[model samples]
Target: MTSLTCDVAVIGAGTAGLAAERNARKHGARTLLIDPEFAGTTCATVGCMPSKLLIAAARAAHQARESDLFGIRTGPVEVDGPAVMARLRRERDRFVSATRKDFDALPEGTRIRARARFDGLAGRLSGGQARLILDDERVVTARAVVIATGSAPMVPGPFAALGDLALTNETLFDLPDLPRSLAVIGGGAIGLELAQALARLGVSVTLFDSGTRLGGVRCDRIHATLKKAMAEEMTLRLGVTPEPSKDGRAERIAWEDGEATFDRVLVAAGRPPNVAGLGLETTGLRLDDHGMPEVDPRTMQCGDAPIFMAGDANGARPVLHEASAEGAIAGRNAVAWPAVVPSRRKTPFTITFTDPPLVSIGEDPDDSAAIGSADYGNQGRARVEGRNRGLARLYAAAPDGRLIGADLFCPGADHLGHLLVWAMEAGQTATDLLTRPTYHPTLEEGLRGALRQICRAVPLELPGDSDPGQPPGL
Candidate 1:
């Protein structure tokens, strides 16, 4: 049997694993990256990039259909399903190819295209090294190991019985053409985005979730607004648990009150960590009931061992940027070993790329003094563009009116979320933000209006009365 040794060995070559491997090498440690398939990252290959490509196409078709509201009449907005899928695949391949190039550019002999598992018998050696058994019968020992194997989509048993009729994000983009009708089985970010995109692409979409909430939105006002906007496009069956069964060539989704048949079911159910076959029992570390090691978010270390867990595998923050940051921390600590230092994490930010996107940044204070809100129903830009149909709320701490968190379900939410996150991170207060100039007929005006509301509630003393009269272009 072949044997290999390295200072750091990273398992799984996804975003987190790649970041860990790169950072370990940057720290002057001999690092090895292992993955059964070095195709690309989850984001580029299946998660973000490809999904966005489909959303982009759907946006184009939607805009064309809605152009009539702007006093411009157009012919029937026809979406060529095959053509859309073709472009999505073409562009998605480019992204995947780029990621593969990055993997190929790694130092020769450092990238191993093999599956690896912990050596159950050896565990951790007395020298603080861990042994890994590769699929090719090669044994590798490393001073520190980082597990970034990522996660896999969870398909319930009933849906699994439907065979190929059930699709997950990993396989949805491979469809040659869009299905006639689709039932999305989750109301989180993935389900909301794909259901809307498919609906806009002329597919009959019915979205179901056991809970009434959509996208895990914290604010009730934002949830209500988002649900209304989404309902205008497709059927939303919230607060219902659906049972899937075979109905000839199609799938039948029956709930407490109603039953419907769809060409296919898109399972946006949560993805658990892909840790089943990694042989974690052999790691000589304590594992939780779910087989996850207790990882320190600040240090990314698994217990006191020289092993680390990052990204989705840890089930902390599953976002791409968070995964990358955690991987870096794990990699650096893996190289530093016993002298690992804790790293600070960024403000929590999440966005669902729906029509009027849903975004949440930072944590909502438990005892918020005031909540500033803006309604898009009559916002100048929203009314002018004929695309506005949502709400935005900014939370403030008591007394000082410090901007603590924000939940937005409105146009330019993606941009507004970033701005609010930066402001919160910089410790900006409501009165402090109100001092900034807001452009005329822009989405920032909505944020400014919300900030003004906060100032009113807290009665903060400012350099000048920032709550000026709203003029058309002022």
Candidate 2:
């Protein structure tokens, strides 16, 4: 059998694994990265990129269809579904190529096309080095290991129905044509994102979740806003338990209260750590009570001499951004001069890319009192732009006025990354935001108004002390 050794071994060549390899190489460590699949899921070939391409095309079709609102008229609309899929496929190939190039770019890093598993727990190889075996029976020895083998969609309760019609995030982009109607199974970020995008594309969509959509968000207000905006189209089945997947025009899914029908079932219930057949027993790494690898939170070190876990397999947030960040941190720290462990950072910001979008950062809503909020239903720019329905909430330290959290219900909240990051890391205060110059008639100016509005909640007296509804001259 072929054998090799490296300073660091990263299992899984997805975003997390690739990032880990790059960081390890940067720190002057020899690294080996491996995954069974040539094309990484989500970030690379199928997940976010291709899906968003579909969303953009879908939205463009929608806007073009509604041009009458703009005092313009166009021919009756027909969505070219197959054309959209073709474009998505072309984009996906590019991403896959880019990911492979990222691996090739890292010096001293070797890419292996195989799955790996620990072979023994002696904590030392027969040759006084740690050893792992590949699926093809090739052996590898590494001083440190980083398991960035990321996550995949969980099969919903009814496994039998997955036959052909059912699709998950990994398989959705392969569709040659959009479904006439789509039933998204799960109300979490994945479910909501796809549901909204498909619905806007003229696919009748029904979103089902056992819990509330946007569950566990720090702000209920944010969820409410999302619901209001999303309700413009699509059916949202909240707090619903789904039925088994079955063959039919309408997949019959049941909840505790009742059942419903959907055309295409897209299961995105959740992700479990990819731990099966990993040969952890050979490394003396025991699964925790929750059946996840028990490891030091800061170091992610498993048992014995060299095995470490990162990304979704480590049971961290199953978010691509978080996994990639964690991988970078863990990979570099694992190979530092004497190998100093890294501390995990607070998840910075997450957004649901629905209309108007929803964002949450820092303070869990349990600390909502530290939170202050402002809304702009009708403002100068909003009116001029013929836009409304935006809100921004601030969570600050009561003692120092430092901003801890900022949830935006406005447009382009994603681009507020730098300011928001500073607020969290540097403890900048709401008042400090005043110093940042905001362009007039731009969406950003709304931040200033939101800041002032949240900072002061005093009731303002109306003109003439009138209730306005009591007749002006009376």
Candidate 3:
């Protein structure tokens, strides 16, 4: 067996692993990056990029079909499934190729295309560092190791029996042709996004969610609105417990309320961390209930070992941006060794790219929080655009009027989500937000309306009616 040595070893070549490897190299450490699959980050390859491509196509088709609402008559619009899939593959392959090129451009021999496992405490090197045994029978020794193995979709035992008949995020993008009818299991981001996209594309989609709400929208009003909107587009079966069975080429799934036979089944169940076969015992670290290494999220460091866990493997925050931040922290701490420094976290923000996208940032709205709200039914920009339905509710600390959270189900929610994220990060108060300039007849004005309510709720001393300096209206 060949033997190699490096100052740091990063497992996995996805977003988090790449970030860790780059940062470790920048810190003057000889870093080795290993993965059976090269570049092709999850976002670009299977998760975000390809899915958005499909969503974009569906959006164009939907708009064309709905043009009559704007007094513009467009004849029957048809979506060519094969052509859409072809375009998706062409564009997706190009993105993957670009990522591969970038990875190849890195210093020669720095990346190893093989699966690796820890050699355990009993097999430590002379310097007391951990060893990694590559699938190719190569042994690697490193002073510091970062596990960024990422995650894989979890398929329950029943669904696993269906084999090729079942689809997950990892396999859905690779489909040869769109199914005539589909049954989407789970109502999380992946499930809801794909279900709606398919329904818009003229597929008979029946969505089943074991949960009481759709897409995890905790606010009752927002959940109801989203449910109504989605219902208008397709069949939504919430609070369902599904029993799936395979019938040759066709699949039959039955829930408590009803049953249906779908041409294909797409499981959007949660992803479990890819921790299997990593030999956790060898790392001298204790595993959590989820079988993942116990590590402090702030430092991304495991117990007292030189090992660190980042990205989906850590199971802290599964979003790509959060994974990148954790990866940077792990990379830095790996190099610094005994003196690990904590990293500042970004304000929490999540968005689901559906029509009138759903967004939630920072703390979730609750009863204890002061509420400020605005409806888009009368917003000028929304009315002019002919897409005026949804609401924005901002939550502030009751005592100090600090902008703490926001939940929005409105047009242009993606932009609104980012704005709220920045406000929370900067510790801006409701009063401070109102001071910012807002243009007329814009979606942002809806945000201004909410802030105004918050300012009105706070007992700010205004000019008295008897004061001569007060304006006539005041």
Candidate 4:
């Protein structure tokens, strides 16, 4: 077998691996990035870009249908499923091509187009080193390793038996035509987003969530609003699990209350880390209950091993931005191993991009000292757009008005979530955010309304609030 050596080896060429490789090189370390499939990043390939493309088309169709409310009538709208899928593929390929260009521009010999597995230790190196066995009969000895293998969509064992009849993110984007009917078997972000999108685009979709709630919104007011909005788009089967069985030439997903057979079953259950066949035993690292490497969340370093796990591979924070941040931490720490430098995690920001999207930011509002809310039913922009169907809640410490958390279920929420994410990260108070100018008749005004509630409820006493238009001393 041919042999190669590097200071660091990064497994997987997805977002996390690429970030890790770039940061390791920045730190003056010789790095080898490895992945069997150099197709593109997951977000570009299937996760985010393609899904959004489908959603955009679906929204256009839904909007056209709903335009009658505004006295704008476009009659007899028909959806051509095959044509829609074709356009989706074409646009998705452009994004994938762009990502591939970024990968191709990496320095020569930096990326290896092969799968890798741990091959025990390299005794020759003075410090602890790992031996990586490549599929092409090549070996690499690296002083430190970063596992960024990303993840795969989690399909239940029974669903796996359906083969081509069942679809996950890995296979969903590749379909040449849309299915007539679909059973979406998870009520998380992916499931709800796709279910609603497909339903809007003329596909019959039934969404089932085993849990009592949908998304992660803990507020009853917001959750009820989201559930109502999504229910109008697709059949909702909340607090129920579907029993799956394969019948001749058809698949059936039956629940206690009802049953349905569909042309396809889309599983948005969860993602399992791509840890299989990596030979973690050879690296002397024990896998956690989730079959993920037990790595420090801040450092991304695997336990007691000269290795690190980042991004979806660690199975903690799986979003694109979080993956990138984790990759940088893992990369830097891998280069400066034995002496650890941990980084502080940023304030958590997660958004589910269904219509009137669900957003979770910062701390848990359920445990907050005080909670305040704004109902979008009265917001000007929402009323003008005929989408006034959600609410925004702000959590803060009472008496001090320190912003702790914020949740929203409102139109244009993806953008709205970012504002709160920044504010909470910068330690802005509810009253402080209220001082910022809010554009009249915009969705952002809803944030101002929510902040005002928090300010009123907590009543933070600022020096100037006692006497308006006068200096505090005067």
Candidate 5:
């Protein structure tokens, strides 16, 4: 058996693993990056980039169809399913290639192409070092370890029984052409985005979720607005668990009341961490009910041990930015070992890429927080753009009027969410933002309107009314 030694051994070569290896090397630690498949990051290969490409094509078709609203009469917008898939695959491969080039540029002997498992017996003999046994019987002993093995899509038993009739994000983009009809299970970000995109592309889509809410939006008003908008575009079966079974060559999904057949069923339920095969039982760490180690979010450490877990492997935050941030923290601390320092995390921000997108930033509002809202239906810009549907809510702490968080389901929400989170991180109050310049007839005016409402509810000792040029002490 071959033997290898390194200061840090990083398992998996996805987004988190790559960041961990790079940061560990930058911190002057000898590192080995191990992965059986050297495919690029999930974002480039499957998760973010390819999904966005598909959404962009859907947006084009949707815009062409909706052009009549702007008084511009247009011919029928026909979607070429094969051509769409061709472009998505072409662009997705280019992104994957770019990431592979980065891997190729790494120093020789830095990457190990094999599956690694913790050597249970060696953990007792190697002092504080982590012992990993590769698939080829090679042994790796490292001073510290980073588990960034990432995650896989969860397919429930019913869907899995259908075999190739079921699809997840990892296999969704590889379709030869768009299906004639699709049943999207789970109304989270992945299901909502793909379901809407496919519907715009002329596919008959029906979305089902056992939960009533979609995209994790907590605000009842915002969720209602989103549900109304989505219902107009496709079928929605909320609060129902679907059972999938084979109907000849097609797939049938049935709930208590009704059933429908589709060319394929997309299972977007959830993705659990890839920790089962890593032999955590050998690590002597206390694992939770889900078999995940007790990890410190600030330090990315597993208890007081030299082992660290980051990114999707930890299942804390599965988004790309959070994965990258956790990887950096785990890598730097792995090198520092017993003297690990805590990292300050960024304000929480998430956006669902559905039409009239859903955005949530910072913390969800508590009952004690002052609430303010703006209806896009009356916003001048939104009305003019023919997208005058949705809502925006801003939350602020009482007395101080400081911005705490916001949930937006309106036009230009992706951009609006970023601006609001930046202001919150900068410690700016709702009244403070109202004093800033807001251009007329723009989506930002909606934000300003909400801020003004927030200023009215919170007890701020302002110079005058929340709006400018108003009487003092009004």
Candidate 6:
């Protein structure tokens, strides 16, 4: 048997744990990073990256099919599924080679193959006793621990007996052939994005959501347009519940009038934190009523007797990105301070990648006494790019003039996310954005226009001196 110890034991290699390890190494703390098998999951190898690759391929396929709309005539476009998958793999390998090197190449870093749970004295291995296991064989010891384990796709209630004949985001892309028809169990982010993607791939898709509306992360301003766009592509089974078919052929969907069957079912309500087993009790880590490790928000610390927690395992939503950020903070605190203070710089931003992806920045829309905003219906770029289909909703401070939040639904969403993220972080008011000129014809200018209108409605402080049409000093 082999035994080792480190100053910090980060128990996940997913987004947050990996980030934590990098920061810890930078601070010269000896780090031990552990995960069950691969160092990646939905976000890296499977979930976000691969899903986006598939979406891009689907978009290309859509373009080829709709070439006549752009005055390019061609024969019918067919999908080369295998080649598309190969491209995804080649790209994935290139990405892994680069990003994985960032961690595996870290000096003084230790990675163990086995999974360790909290044993009473120290983490124990089978038949190896450097430290004694709990009398009941469930406890372990560590100087300090951070749980950065992330979340997984939620399983649907109707498919309770679904051992097979089911797909979650984790396993959906593993198919060699696309299903003829897909019944999406939930109409949240995953369902909307995937339904559109599969529909473009020539699969008949039916989206089922219990609410009267679809798209869980939709904004009030663009919700109707997004719903209409998606409805044109797939069956919109809104305001309905689905019961498991007796034979599991398809969901027995219950709507106001009738029901039907589908070839495959996709469960995509949301993500649940991956918190089970691992024996949190040995460290005296207390879980909230939800059976997740409870932590102090500012410090991201949890567990009792020298333990801390981060990531989805602790029940954080908007999970991955936050977990990665929180994990770095938690890991650094666990090593240097040991006093356990956790902090993050900015509020979380979220996106849903349907056709014309939807992005959101700060405060919830339902909040009372709404702040000032500008919508992007009247931008030149919108008309030029042929996407007058989306909206940009901005929110700002009451009277002091600070940008609070923005939710964007439009084309080029992947690029738009970075722009909005920058604006929100800089506390750039609508006036600030307008002061910075965007190029003549681009989606970005629409963002600038949206800001200009919002500022005109409830004007914020301007540049020291301004021209009527140009940004400061331009």
TM-score per prediction, in order, is 0.96, 0.88, 0.94, 0.94, 0.96, 0.86
RMSD of each: 1.8, 5.3, 3.5, 3.8, 2.6, 4.8
Question: How accurate locally, in lDDT, is each candidate?
Answer: 0.90, 0.70, 0.84, 0.85, 0.89, 0.67
lDDT of candidate 6 vs native?
0.67
Please list the residue runs of candidate 3 whose C-alpha ends up more than 4 Å from where it truly belongs after superposition. Answer: 122-127, 365-367, 460-474
Of candidates 6 and 2, the better by lDDT: 2
Candidate 5 residues lying further than 4 Å off, grouped into runs, are: 121-127, 461-474
Q: Give a tens-digit lDDT track for model 4, residues 48-85.
A: 99999999999989999999999998997899988888
lDDT of 2 by residue, 338-440 (tens): 3466585764677766656667777564443355555656645654544567677766655455667777766666665446766678666655665656666
Ranked by lDDT, the better of candidates 1 and 4 is 1
User: Candidate 3's C-alpha lDDT?
Assistant: 0.84
- Give the Å shift of residue 325 in candidate 5: 0.5
Model 5: how far is 251 from its true place, Å?
0.9
Once all C-alphas are superposed, what RMSD does model 4 give against the true structure? 3.8
Predicted candidate 6 versus true structure: per-residue lDDT over 1-474, tens digit per residue: 345666677777777787777777677777777667745544767677777888988898887876776688889888876777677777765665666775567565376544666655343222122121222433233355666767777786657566556788877776676778888888887788888998898888988888866665546656776787888899898878776564545545456677777677888887877666666655445666766666776777663334566776666555467877777887777675446554655666777888788777776744522243334455566555455566667676655456777667777665877777787788766677667766766667556545555565566655444434423321
> Compared with the true structure, what per-residue lDDT tens digits does model 1 show for residues 363-404?
756764688888877888887888667889998888888888
Displacement of the residue 247 alpha carbon in candidate 4, Å: 3.2
